[model samples]
Target: MIERLENVVTFLDKYIAWMFVLVAVILFILLYLTYQCCLKYCARNLSKRDKPRHYRSSTLQYIRFTQVVKTPPRLSTDSHYQTIPLPNY
Candidate 1:
């Protein structure tokens, strides 16, 4: 009877281990799918074309402004600040 009980216990241990492994695999798959879905959703919604026209125009304006700010003003022969011609957006 003791031997039979030991065999049963060993079987149960293996069965429980396999069950845990299966659960872990399933959970991992679910998590990966969820992450993929979130990435796709974000990419779709955050695409440049999906943005509002005003938002895109404002962003371009900001970029132009930054470029103008980055350029150093040239000094003329008279040591006066030369006016930089700003590009029309």
Candidate 2:
């Protein structure tokens, strides 16, 4: 009975280490994917450095997707600023 209990404990310890390694690998993969997404976004917006028209369009698309609206000032003296309204829901 003592030998069997020791074997069970050893097995549990080994599998716990393996579980930790698996979780670490999954976290690394997710981090890498997020990094790739950031790189793609930056490339799209900045690839048209020489062309203002394309750059602006790309920026506008990003802004639209992010739900950022540029609200014009109601008064002549008011400043122009971007606004992201909160969702009612």
Candidate 3:
């Protein structure tokens, strides 16, 4: 058992860097696939008009109104700046 453990340790020591790289590549692929799936799901939902009854909740029903007001901009008269003194710590 000790000999087997030593052999395994030696193998791991030699290929630990490669193992890290392999794990990173696997994680990147997993995240990319998840992102793609999320995008596809979002697109599919956005393209369809008919949604499930559960999705047709009353919370989505609301009235939205926008009012645009035209206002004149105020111009600054004085160019002089005032400086305040700070206390030393």
lDDT of each: 0.81, 0.70, 0.61
- Of the candidates shown, which would achieve the greatest TM-score relative to the real structure? 1
Candidate 1 vs 2: which has more TM-score: 1
Q: Look at candidate 2 and give me any clashing residue pairs.
A: none
Candidate 1, residues 46-85, lDDT tens digits: the string is 8765554565768777677667767887667775768675
Candidate 1 residue pairs in backbone clash: none
Error of 3 at 30 (Å): 0.8
Kindly provide the TM-score of model 3 when superposed on the true structure, using C-alpha atoms.
0.41
Lowest lDDT sum, 10 consecutive residues, model 1, at 48-57
Give candidate 1's error at residue 42 in angstroms. Answer: 0.8
Error of 1 at 61 (Å): 18
TM-score for candidate 2, residues paired by index: 0.51
- Going through the candidates in the order shown, the clash numbers are 0, 0, 0
Whole-structure CA lDDT of model 1: 0.81
lDDT, candidate 2, 30-60, per-residue tens: 9999999999998987765534453366765
Q: What lDDT score is found at residue 50 in candidate 1?
A: 53
